[model samples]
Target: MRKTEGLLKLLSLCLLAGVLVAGVLFPVVGAAGVASNQASETVDSMSSELATDPPPLVTNVTDSAGNVIATLYKQYRIPTAANQINDAMKWALISTEDRRFYDHKGVDWKGTIRAAISNQTGGDTQGASTLTQQYVKNYLINVVNRENPLGQEKAQEQTIARKLKEARIAIQLETKMPKDQILAGYLNVVEFSHQIYGVGAAAKAYFNTTPDKLTVPQAALLAGMVNNPIMYDPWRKPDNAMHRRNLVIDRMVDNKKLAPADAERLKTEPLGVVEKAPDKPASNCVGAGPENGFFCQYVVDYLLQHGMSEDELFTGGYTIKTTMDQRANDEAKKSAEAQVKKNQPNVANTLSLVKPGKERHEVVALAANRDYGLDKDRGQTTYPLPSGVTNVTGAGSSFKIFTAAAALKQGVAGINSTIQVPNFHISQVFTGGGDQCPPKDRYTRTYCVSNATEGGSGAMSLQTALATSPNTAFVILEEQAGMGPVVEMASKLGLRNSMAGNAATGGPVDPDNENAQFRTSQTAWYGPSDNSPGKGSFTLGVSPVSGLEMANVAATIMSGGVWCPPTPIASITDRDGKPVPYKEPACEQVVDEGLANSLAVGMSKDDMPGGTSHAAAAAARWTRPMIGKTGTTQNNGSAAFVGATPQLAGAAMVFRPDSPNGGLYDRGPGNVVAARGTNGDMFGGKTPARTWFGAVSKILEGQPELPLPPLDPRYDRVGRR
Candidate 1:
């Protein structure tokens, strides 16, 4: 009986021992279960969040033909798929990172235990994390950085809690994603170096090859970089990279993925790293290639000003197809460079081309001689647009077309309307007929107009006056047409003042003035204003106007009075190849078609003998019929030529930025005459005209001749008729 009682006591003690062990293990199992649940929830939440918002992608700007012109990116990552990756690369990565990747669900308990023992024993550290766990950690870090930047430090902290969360999330991820897909996502997002992420980017950056083209050694090198990219950057530390690469090869051999002989051969071989400098993608127009910089910048400015979201432009992977003609842009650059070479280095020139069409008014080419940059010494800003080196120069006599249009629109005069040619005119209040000077000091009678020369006299047809660009005759027409109508015509034709008020009207409305009601109609000039000289001389192109606007004006006439606002973009698409809606061209009929055609006819006369731009037309010798006007600002401070065929309208300008009010004639370096004229001074009909002709000649190459509309016979009167 005593023996039986002792055996029972021993059995009870054994039972107690079993219960203690069970008690110890139960909490661990429960804790693991709770942790796993938390991870699953976290992963579910993360997956939901990611489904709604993907990472920012690089935006690409392409030409009309879909050739990539520029790339814009916030992070230089180009994701690649798992199937697209080379077998060698996949094996190398798997062998180096997690040999048992296929066997484990998410956490490698055996490897983790081994790593824990190694850590305690002060042995070489081994990464116990599986590929999925690593991906989960990276995903968590990315989410934390994106959603809660302030918690990034805590997210990256090497703590037990973080590891447990990673393992749990990894398990959830394994259940939700295919193993190959998880590998692809991890490969795509893993950072290989500064500004370089993903196997695709790293492949291109280091070997100048695609992921699928990566050789065994190259793949091994890249796979090894995931541990510490900075330390093993092949470009910076070739020796360290070589050593790490060999280690990867050794691991691949041990994993039985690579033949022993092949592995040894690759280990002895050079890294074969072909270091290609990553293309630091340009974010703005200023960084576009030299030939495309200014034009690109113009597009950027246009989009930004037209309500495009700035963030979207930089990171939304938008595909913008611009209207820029690569051929025209190239020719324009050559022409501008040739013209700029003839003047002082500081002298800036601009050329703008616009295609006139019923569907869209496209700015085909915008080119300047210099590159776009921040250096003031070298012109950076696009010359045609307002910049430190350029502002709106007076449109000069090119403003006469507006006056001519106004007269025709108001029926105040026709092409046959006659005005006796005179050396000058001083008037108090303009009456369409003759110059009438009011008594001196009347403030209202302040009109003084003069011609460039004194020659033709007595009853010249208005057409002849315009062809000759007679300042006195246009001023007379402006008086006859009434300043209100003349100003209205200019405004409707897309003239914008860079100053505070309308370009046509000098400034803000004077509440006390009788014409306060008229202020609403005058808003088209584009630059800072000089004090308004209340006189008819305004028709002489005294107001500051950009070349772009001038080109638009010419294009309007070319379009037979239909004003299509200038646009540089042809189409825009999102990253997913979906079209994004944008504003269509704002079209308006600004003048009578017949009136515009008649004015075009008169302007074409400038290409005839004795016309203002006749010399320029002769120089161009275009196969197609062309019409153009020459403009010389008062004191010869600026010179311009605006011309057009039925297909295209363009403007060219030459001005001194420092001494804008000073003459462009004989003022260039070495007394180089910028505007060749009769009196050894620059004239609008000379250099500006020649430059426009040169540029147009190249632009019209291979283009079929299209004639302007026939002149309305109602106003076909000629000189002295």
Candidate 2:
């Protein structure tokens, strides 16, 4: 070419020297306004972000014993220390990206001039940016302006201004961070895939190995990806990636880090990446597996419900230590799935547990028959079956305990007080829709109710009534106790979702919901369906309910009547290992400790020979001295059982949520509510009880069997208050 002009010739000479690079170097004379105050600020801000901290690392969800169940990330990154990376990786990067990396001060001026002249002379397109400059570019896109599209576009814009800014920032970074740290950060922050990032994460993801254990070929392949990850992604373009990887090997040989013979030999080696990456980051609860998926979701929802944003959870690099007992969760999951197959579209079995403590109640598990996922055709669902009031979920007679609490509080009936129950009750006192009552009683909506069992309705104490789950007896007692007190007690004892009507959706208020018409607090469970005050079936558990809250109800009783929020996370730590403070509802004494102790004593007969769950308990071979109650809705639409020891409390519930019309508990034949493709013999005393026994027993194994607190004699008689 003829003699180059003023700027071009002068720039060429200075570029080859690599001396006075970005420091003593003169700015481009013709490139006016390229180094504005805004550009200076950009360089300074980016250098500060890098010098202070690296990019965001992955946030992990760990079970009680420290097993990672889930990973949440805006980018799949696991920042490792500079010294931790394999030397092979360092060599591979230095050889391929910048052979004069150590010699240059951030900008490879010689390479830059060569690239410019070659491109102008009809040569192949080439990049001249050194490792530090490349690191600055990636940091801007992935870390500083990760979520800002315009900022990312500006970062990658092909303009002299952009190059000048990057060169300036890279020089600043070289001055601040150690070379090793800069390299390590670049390796950590670089993207390997949309969901795979960092050498630490990418090593494990691609080869199921750690950074320190990476082989030379593996390092070469990864280093090559820095140039064009999209065009050479091994999954999408294995052949292209292989050719680029071999090129990296050749560069290593040229750098004298690898022998020519070895380079040629290694070039013939397979890409050797695993067919698919293992432990690849999956963003949501779906990655936590089928059973722990429910627990994972609970952790996410609980955090989001309590003021945590989705972006913070995914990108804030928090280590979420959940309270879930993995063993208990695994056992509970197996038990629940054993009851109803996951593929049983019409049937769902769910369980949740709360560990009872004086100060806190930790949710140990939230499990269901259905796998927690997004695929609907494969019979998967994200429904909060274990924690929310999904569908019209009624707990049947299990709610008798709530009425019992109210009765004990109001002094209407005590543990030892006797109430005679007939086969059916014609409630002259309370009135609501009574369509399930005998045809003669249905016309008056007189709140008529009957016993589910045959021939055992005689005079019985309150404790015996609970064990037998006598519906008519509880209805009469509820009438005597009053409606508002029973509903209030249920809420106080942990039936929060059932009481709120909208708490299931995580919002406490919805103006368009029935909350507008009903006294907001009483709308869900206590309010009148026909614009009246009393829910005739309140004591019968004839309302939507949450299995987790029900388990908390049992935990409330077990914790000396202290109602605590069923919190899933035990603790949260930030990237620096500093504790992140989180506050949940405080534990409060919702009922007299004496009354709860006495109720525990009264409900202990549930697994005995004469009690409703006796047969199922016997089948489970259970002998733990614990208190429990079973409930079955009319037509067997749903069944549930709440059980507890001094250590822990849990609830199991079964329903056919898929069958909309009835989700009926069709007892084999003669019931129109029979769900499709079911054995149709579901009851609280059957699958619910069996699942409860199977799961809770395993969790309670090896723990000391603490006896229930002594019954307060004041709770032995009627009308104490």
Candidate 3:
């Protein structure tokens, strides 16, 4: 007996050694021995044990007041805990998918053996996958898709090798998570239709209800869809869906999860599916609210440009709070729409409001008159047209504020300084190397400039010239200050020269290229173009700038020369509600308070009686001090009004793209009539100014009245006369 026992022990040791050798030789192969080479590779790459990581959830975007403006989702999913899900749905899924789910480890070997026998006996193919196995499969699929996009298709194939790998992962997942947690994850990651994934989304899509609110019939119907969602979609095949739902109800009754009477009653009920999939959940800003769509798009574009990847944006559940005040945004939109309706239907209008903050420049409102869509004829462009950090349009005369600021800063002129103004011509004053004229007049040593009104030229103070918006006065001022200083000053004030130049090209320009040179001379009026170096016209507002930029310019003055690059985002929080790192607003004192105050006085004069924007001032009916500039581009191609108060600043612009030379005046007869409106001719002080007033008045309705700072004593006497 002792000899026999020793021999058995020796045999057992040899067998154990042989098993160890096999494990060492084939480490990737699972114990099931059915895993494919690809599955072996996948298992070898993963941890020894797998853990459940929930899929991505929807991100929420809120306005300044913390009201949800939009919900951005990659899969339109809203995750719910296992307890939060409807009880009926949970039971139904278990009954139909895995009756022995609660009793199994992970693989349900008895069911697998039964399925194998049935298949061997010529019976229909059966699925023996436990709920845990299904969860593991879905999780692995997501992991593969995210980590190895090229191998995703092969990873999803329904082969014995894939099944064995799924079983191994399922056992590991079960060891790491509770049964209820596994069930919840499975429900959350399973696809119900093409873009519809997760039980929460499925409930909403099928019945327009939340997961916890699903009724017995609805629960059963959805539970039945897990096997073959497309084949049993109630929306596509009601009859097939009804049959599947009945089977699930029957299984629930058999498993004693539902009373036979209750099951019978549920079976009798009709599938109350929604008429249409709940307006296929929008994947991006294209589906944002009509009022918030453009702003949302702007936010999206901003994030993408700032190094946030598309995958991260879609998957990361970021909580974004923007600087937009919904009230201001609404008012701006209304004002823009009203102006568009009044003018030619095709003409575009944009209104933007900005305000100063301690840490950043706030974009309170960004509004346009068109819908945010892909239909070109219906005005689909995300208008106000973002240039770089802000939007862009022809600055026209609105740009004179920059030139005026530059002159004051350089001490080349003051609000009281006298400058010769020409009634409609100043070709003789700007005769120099950079003062080259159009090719037709190349040989002429003249660069004639004009005022919007005839017989309005003469000796005028810089303040009066600003209030009147005389093109010749500013051109002469630009020459005196030198284009270099003017351009440099504008740059310091957040006017990206390259972006401004690109705005003149009439096509989309790369906002990312800081060194991109301005290419077209026609739009050069929008900005100083390298191609057209004689920027004597720079002071005349020839460069294009967005309404937001103009508003920022005004905001800079309001902030006493502190230029804070405008930012829409107020705060960003990650999934755990922790602040994410982002670039802080770069605030710089670009101009002296004295110079800014002097310019403010000039703009304030424009809104006073006899000033060019007097009509707008009247319309605004402001009770507090306000300063503004009115701008009408050459040939009336565009009209703009930029204004600032102690508390707020805004800009409005109207463009006539189809008009002759893109002039607002040459817009169709309807536009001409709407813009003229018994005012004789459309000017910057008319439509654009009025639009700004109409919107801003509403925005400032309840705000406390604040007065602008007193002008610097040195220049107080210059423009007052």
Candidate 4:
């Protein structure tokens, strides 16, 4: 009887202490209620608030095909046998947060009183949270909701009304949802740092394993992260996170949830942080650099801006079929590189002429190269200067390819038409200039004719002139055809911007403009006219062009006038392997098959013995046949080449910008710097050709090289003869 009475007194004291702790921790009372009388009312009010609002609805994720990727919820309800939510979260939370959770109906009055006494006496720290209360807080309450990118914002720490509300919600949830569901929800919605939102993501992120694969120690560590996700991020700060995890394990052992031996073993266990590559593409491919695949990059940029995603590019698994064969594209780059290297040494030296401090080395080199001849390390020679000059511009001679096409299209010239080269000149009526004279001047030298009326000449068929790339001969033809037909033809050939015979610096050739500075007569055929002022003959290229744009244009020509947008990926399928809709294959013809063939055949002369491209002509040694062209601009020391096998086509060009460098000073400035330089010159036939050859040879290892088709039989020399 005496022992029983003493036990009863101990129980009464514990209960009293719990109540006092609760009173001090949460003192707010309901209206019209005095202390103890209002306790139930306060609890009821809290419960009602929690019941009124549930968590927000989560968003769904999808795949490229618009198929359901994942139906995301804060918590996953699936239950695993051994890896049950109870074992994973462990008993640490229950003992530390809620000692009497299972024993109490909804609230633990005894624990609450014990906590109150501890607070008053300063004997032990006190907190009134039950297991259910903590669970509710983890999943339902907004207590841990963060407002910053990182979860450093503190939640409202003290709230009587909030605590009361938490209690009510806990009871309601326990009554409404199954025990397993409540546990699952809490685990699914918990935050573990580094954007990991659920137990599954956290498991994979921290341990490189799944929830079902976690050990007791790993589980305990995860449980400790609930209080502070960042400070306890296992992968980032393992030492701190491990300490917290060990604390939880200690608590579980004290509460009898874990064996003493197991606890001791777990304490010494090494933490293993899983290594996971980010779920994005590796950013170190050819697509990521300045020297990326120039042609490929342009196509990709166009597709992206016009409408396409990175996913579609790499993983969509679509097959992209282009007009040009990959083998051909490779050949083009190799040939260009090889051709450019041969002349680069000379060009580089000319560019380096001026000493570093002599002026800007490049400027002096450029000015020096333009004025006098360059003495190459190999040998010294003076080269011819191109017509009227200033700074380098696009190649004017090569621009005639389009001119010839336009003339043929307008019926002004036929492949067999023969014209005499004379003092070819365009009158003011033709040039739109204030005065007109035979397009002849002091600068006029190569290919200039005195006059049809004066003593001068060279007679050749239109095909022959195109084959030889003659300037004076074409100017006479241009005068006979008139500018209107020529201008219209240029537009059809895809020339968006035009240049009049005379135009201001940077002005497009506008026929309607009465006054133009670029105006030149028949002599302008080879390049810039002698009298007109400008610079290097980069004009032989007709202005700068990107490798990609040129590639596409060449594709159109090679495809017999068909142009199509380039695509890297062939297709995109859903997670379940369903196909998605995208742009259908688009192709359109831009030229007549005959015209393309004519141009191809004409360009082939460079490979013939009396032709300009002797080095490329050496392909005669190989089993396959190749065709190429050599181009040099007068004013600017620039060189260019374009070539194609039946399977591929590409263009490559090299020119000094503004001035030469310290290296090339020994060379005279301008085209003169490279004038005496021959097919062996740096720009025209060497480096660019080598690059094109190397790239193509590798790609065409096992492939057969085919010859181009003949031009229209009606215009063939054999037929005419």
Candidate 5:
């Protein structure tokens, strides 16, 4: 029976060779007909396209000083070169997957013929694909057609067409590349387990090590997983994985790639895999950890907003260099948390820092009391608290700076220009833009403004008004400057984000809806564009605002009146270090240089004895040539402080970040401390200003004290530009 079987196999091989010769020598005698033409065309087209693009690599993000902080990628792969991988990795893979890999051109025709015959005769289906063929197939599915469902299916479908395509591509690949190079490429592209690809990521994921440190057993286990990573995952199915790994080890020994004694010893060893992969580079901003994550998130958002798509950023393998200063971020986080504990609920203390430059304003750091994470229980929140407007309730008289800027721009007021300050007054030019006026109240149906503290009565210079933060004084100045310029000035200075919506209320910023004033859309609460007389209270600062915008506002002022869009990116480059284009920074001289310099000096006394933030600055023993402003909303609900010097600019705010209507004193279920100062009040000069000094003072520690632009005397009084 055995002799007859051997004769039959030999006769079958001869018959197959005869059919192939007849088809090639005499095409018209072929039985395949059009299928032969289609098969030939498929081979030709598939072989034409070789390895065009390399596989995806990890995209790294670094800080301003070039310290890698985070990594973004789709496949979580660490592409290793041929020489970077351990010899055991390549040898184990080739020995187990294709023993004749070194000798064969691309495919083993003998094994292919035997496997095809047995498969056609109802024997078990066998895969006679060589290492080069497997590499071609994996490259097709994972690299070329990774995002194409139909193309991926075509590459993976179990059919003769797929096999032929792989064989053709593999043959072409062999002609262009060496065997070792093909082996390295194959190991770099194939999947080892869920979200784990390449021998580099696999070694780190499975054993908490690198490819260069992989042992014989470690390499064998990873090599075995490429056949079916999901099925042989050591964590999910240790027994099946053990059996598969043992097969690779045994095959290596059979091929003399490993010693018999070593194979036996390795087989007896336990499957050593880490309980879970430390996904350091796999997570997006989450991997950045704690305070650094917020800056990472900002960089991601900034890139998306400018032009880069999410897919391109995560998978394009580009290097992102951000302007985030790690030291500044750390100091800001420490200070903000000291003022408002990270565990403090419903209230958030935030600080934003920007470096002022005549041509560009770079955002250096953003920090908040809340952590940047998903754990709500651990007082973690992902809200861009330090840079956004969503958590702002109001900034009170802090906006007096914009109103003052408008007045200076229009030549209607100067640093020493005196304005009447009344303890309380009903504006003749403005009307109440909300329902705050009670029906029977004395100030009913009118725009009422008052100073938060007494003795703000009588006449005061615009400079003194700024330091004391008297609402009535700014109201009077806003009326003199007219509503239009004051509103536009806020937008130009940096409150543009707030000028798009009404403050404290969700009412849309409707310039046409004159009736919006009756609903908090105008009067003291309207956005910057609402130039109606009803918005005369714009100088009183009742508007939604962004901390980042406010910080840049201070930067704009410090930059000698040049307004530049704050950017978080230092630079971006492709994997090969080619420069990537981004939106060019734009800076405008919105204010006259002389007028802005004088204005900075005018507002410089906010930390003086009579100033609002004097107590806070004095407590820190702060003595620096800086300008600052303090503001508190009505009823002490929320407040903000903005301050800056020639070297650094920053904004700090303490507000109710949880509930829309929740007041600073109204504690929430998660509250450990209410948003209040030691004086039992929510004031910008208190906790908020302290938050600024706590952070900014340290952030500016070693910087040289450059004097602010010399004040032009012409603008000290009511001198026009």
Candidate 6:
């Protein structure tokens, strides 16, 4: 009976040894066999193991039509399975992190035993940690083991404890997870330094490609960096990194993972690190360098803070379908910059907010006096010149846009209501004794037939006042419409971000108070103001208004009252490219269609025989029928054109608000620059109009003709039909 029992024990020992050998030799099928045995034994019944699924990945934004617009990701975690990883990387990981990886059970017993022996002797604390344990540490524990010098790790003694804990976890994980899940966890856990957290990031950071696109040698180099991020950093020490990579190749050959010849050939090849930083998530959209650098930076910063995540914001695979056409913005930026350069040659050197570096130019223009006045040459200087004290220039005639719309909204004016403009002026009282007149009224309130007379004042039709931008005519209309109604109209036109809200409501905005610097300045009602010296300009447009706000204003009239805020990013998708829900623009009609049509009446006048913008108005002008208004401010000589087509409506502005040497700047108020020259004048009529024309031309490309409103039947009664 004793002999028979001994024979059974011997047979069991032999079977166990055979199983171990099989597990070591065939890791793939062996894992399956282990799982099968566990299932048969009902091991899962005792272990309460839970599998973790990753959050839905937001890879990029798409347009309304489902085109990619941006890429988004969280935790910066990218999964790199064995299939997605390079063979070289696999070998490197096995050789350095776990040489006996396949040969072990859920735990590397031999390595643990060896490490235990070494720790007992106080030999340089080498670890016996498996890839599974490292993954747990990185993805689950989130602890940084910074004890050892050779790599980022704890002592062998501590490592053994961690490995034991990991062994228990791995067993539990295997019971609950599929092989792919385990591999994905491993891929996401591995980190390569230099802000790279996974194989995917490493692939992009080093080679400017994705994991699947990586070559064997490239993969090996990346894998080598896992053990010692700094020592194997490709950018910092290419030689050391390459040497480590070669060691990985050598290990692959010794393990029979690669042919000797293949390993040798790979070692001889040069490391192909990309010359430039891989195109990161956010691209430098403006490639023309520091010219217009401030404006570009402002836009980029805004997008970063409010647009999307770093992943979704900068990834190259996604397309950003911005509300503002990139092409149009770029051209506008270029034209404005070129014009600035032509007009003010030496002014480029003035805007210096930062320390000078390679190709870093900080140039901004400024005004000559603290109060509203004509601009003069200030010449360029280094370091960003302090911004001028910007006072709010009263909206002047532009405010009439609000008044006219309000009158219509309140049933106070008809489209053809022929009201007369008389000698008139509006007054606003300050806390101090004196009363101030609007900047436009500062010169005179005159309704003349031509520009030949200044003191002339007369009664002109409302249509004529609107066509010529008469100030008194709008003031009278404002009284009938009431300030409240006009303010409401401006607000609905998407004109927010102003102190005028409070100022027009008779509130005070103290510019002298540093704590209230960002507060809306009273000048916002008219335009940007030098509210305080040593501070930047405030107000809309050439003052403080965003380009998008201007676009919305035009959109409102063109929509016959509908307003759609500009949308830059469209849709978000997962790593696998599945859609994620997002908030779209809230489309609403903020004005009456008929009222909007009345405003368009005056804009359409600009396209008629004697219209202001008639030079560019022709039968073949815009692909769609259109109407628009041109505004110029004398302060900065900035000119603006707000135009709308039935299909598309937009606006454009040109100004050098931060000029140091005011000479060569806009000659009149900022708004008038567009009307200065015919070819490329400083006035809104010429250069600014041209900019509008160019942008409209591009946006209209390949688009069908826009629908138009039915002809007014008033002509039937007039007999002109």
Best by lDDT: 2
What are the runs in model 6 whose C-alpha is more than 4 Å off?
Answer: 1-81, 86-88, 103-106, 140-167, 178-181, 208-216, 276-397, 423-457, 498-543, 616-624, 657-682, 701-721
Instruction: Quote each prediction's TM-score.
Output: 0.79, 0.88, 0.85, 0.51, 0.88, 0.67
Instruction: Give the root-mean-square deviation of each candidate in angstroms.
Output: 8.1, 4.6, 7.0, 15.1, 5.0, 11.8
The candidate, 3 or 6, that scores higher on lDDT is 3
Worst 10 residues of 1 by lDDT: 524-533
lDDT of each: 0.69, 0.80, 0.71, 0.46, 0.78, 0.48
Query: Which runs in model 4 stand beyond 4 Å of their true positions?
Result: 1-238, 241-296, 309-398, 416-468, 471-539, 574-577, 583-585, 617-623, 634-638, 655-682, 713-721
Per-residue error at 422 for model 3, in Å?
2.6
lDDT of 6 at 500: 32
- The clash count of every prediction, one per candidate, is 13, 2, 14, 110, 3, 79
Q: Candidate 6, 58: how far from true, in Å? A: 7.8
Write one digit per residue (lDDT tens) for candidate 2, span 1-721. Answer: 3456756856755563343244314234213553566766766687878888668777899999888999988788877889889889999999999888888877877677677566655688777888998898898888878899999999898765577677777877788888888889889888886457789888988888988999899999999998788888888889998999999999998899999998888888898888864457687788897778888988988898788888889988899999999889989988887777788766778999999877999999899888888889888888787887663547888989988988898898889899877888888667654666444343556668778767964789998988888888888888888777887888899976566554233334575665321234653446444546576777777676789999999999988889989999889999999999875878899999999899999899999998889987897788778899998877667788999988889999887566533434434322222122236546777788888998888788888878888988889887554
1-721 per-residue lDDT for model 6 (tens digits): 9999878866765554454334333324435554455542432332232254442222433323443333343334345665776555566567656766565444564565555555545676756666655565554422123223433443232643345445555555555665545555666556676545677767776778887787778877877887778888777788998898888888777777888998899999888887744334432422212233223333334355454455444432333332323343344444444334423432221111111111111111111101111223433221211121121222223335666677666766554565655554442211111134334245432222112125425664445555555544565565565545665676687565433323212134565543442345322343223531111111112333333355456667766677654434334344455654444446677776656666766556655555445565452274456766655544434445566666555544444434421466434433222212423344444444555565456646787776545433331112322
Q: Candidate 4 vs candidate 6: which has greater lDDT? A: 6
Candidate 4: RMSD to truth? 15.1
Off by over 4 Å in 1: 1-45, 49-54, 106-130, 133-172, 279-287, 342-344, 373-390, 427-447, 456-459, 482-484, 496-537, 657-682, 713-721
Pairs that collide, model 2: 411-719, 636-665
Models ranked on TM-score: 5, 2, 3, 1, 6, 4
Local lDDT at 111 for model 3: 70
lDDT of 4 at 66: 33
Native RMSD of candidate 1 (Å): 8.1
Q: Is candidate 2 or 3 superior in lDDT?
A: 2
lDDT of 4 by residue, 494-565 (tens): 332222333333333454554443432322322333443222222234453322223233444445545454
